[model samples]
Target: MAARAMHVLTSRVGEHNAVILSQEALSNLVGCSERRLRDAVKLLAAENWIEIRRIGGRGTVNAYVINDRVAWAGARDGRRYSLFSATVIAVDDEQPDANELGQQAPLRQLPTMYPGEGQLPSGEGLDPPSQPSLGGLETDLPARRISPPAGSPFDDEK
Candidate 1:
């Protein structure tokens, strides 16, 4: 569910490379309750996968930047942070208040996978994985080209 929410948010990082959306809308897009989304987002922010920039105040639209940890890590490694880099990035170490995070039990840590560590046959990252269908199921169906139907209503415009 967290990954799904991440995908929905990261996908919006199109040409601009950064996206801003309300938490409510983002939760709806990921098909999860806002509570679940908030918990998942806090975990992701802690792991440095995404950055939620504070806007007005609490419960507001914060700038969602993907691939932020990569940049922060690069800086620590003596490399300048470039928005054009293909590497994933991080954000500032600022976190929300503990009360906002709730008094949930500590989450178990998962093994980290760096570049060249876990390579798929197609060489893809795991966190922001590109799953086209259910549960990463790959289909062998031939690709189809989409085209508009024969003109009817808009034909008069020509």
Candidate 2:
């Protein structure tokens, strides 16, 4: 029983030292029924070999700490999801890593914005067009944006 679960656990383990996967996925990785995988998780937790945490329901992913030294791990962030491994990395928001953020990196090297590549910082395209204002005067017009009405489509109904 433990063997099967271990097979599943190790597959999802990573350098971040945390494993978080839904019970169903874990069982699939173990090549056993969900019941058996759950039983194995209980045994491992009871024996102190690992720490498992389950949320409210069955589909919820269970978090694990294989390294016995870590008794508790901070709740993982929702953005840290893994598709193939079913792992959710625990991150320290206080001290963030640029690599970890990747494309979403806050301080990424700005993309090449040559004179005519894309829109300029001022919202004008590389070819800034000149406009004639009301009284035969030439002036630059600021980019105009039109926003939808107050309530967003996602807003709940009253």
Candidate 3:
């Protein structure tokens, strides 16, 4: 389950360490049964590694807040008190298949924005064009090197 939490860590968003995913989705991600997932949740909560804010229901999804001390990806100042504003919800990958009557066929093509509609606030024009050339963009620094600090035992200092 710790491994699963690490995987889900990538999906966390906002200033808070929170993720909104369904039990089924989590179970599938963890390669475990829902029962095992529940048990792991209990253990993690008992260890103060996570907190469950809300359980998913009809028209709702499970909400979880990981202990910032255990795993944090945002600024430290607002982690304790801030609520998640930017959330990325995780759902099952498999879409519902068509039944015998073929009433629920999976959609093949989704609609996309017409060229200029990608801009926010609706009225803004397209962004500036990319730079045409890199003539003046040369860097003076040498290729990056990975080495210990000069004073460290691994350093090449005499």
Identify the candidate with maximal TM-score: 2
Candidate 1's C-alpha runs over 4 A off are 69-158
Q: By lDDT, is 2 or 3 better?
A: 2
Instruction: Write candidate 3's Cα lDDT for 1-158 as tens digits.
Output: 75575466445645756677777777777788878887877777777777665543552346667655333356677554335533546453534442333465687553445443432233346543344335786335557878888889888864
Tens-digit lDDT string for candidate 2 (1-158) = 78778765776686655587666666666788878887888898888888766544764567777765444344577433332222663433323574655465376344344543334445435533433234664445677766645697754542
Best-first order by lDDT: 1, 2, 3
Worst 10 residues of 1 by lDDT: 85-94
TM-score of each: 0.42, 0.43, 0.42
Error of 3 at 42 (Å): 1.0
Model 2's TM-score against the true structure = 0.43
lDDT of 1 at 74: 52
Q: What TM-score should be assigned to candidate 3?
A: 0.42
Residue-level error in angstroms, candidate 2, position 86? 9.5
Clashing pairs in 2: none
The list of candidate 3 runs beyond 4 A from truth reads 10-16, 55-60, 68-83, 92-158
* Cα distance off (Å), candidate 1, residue 157: 70
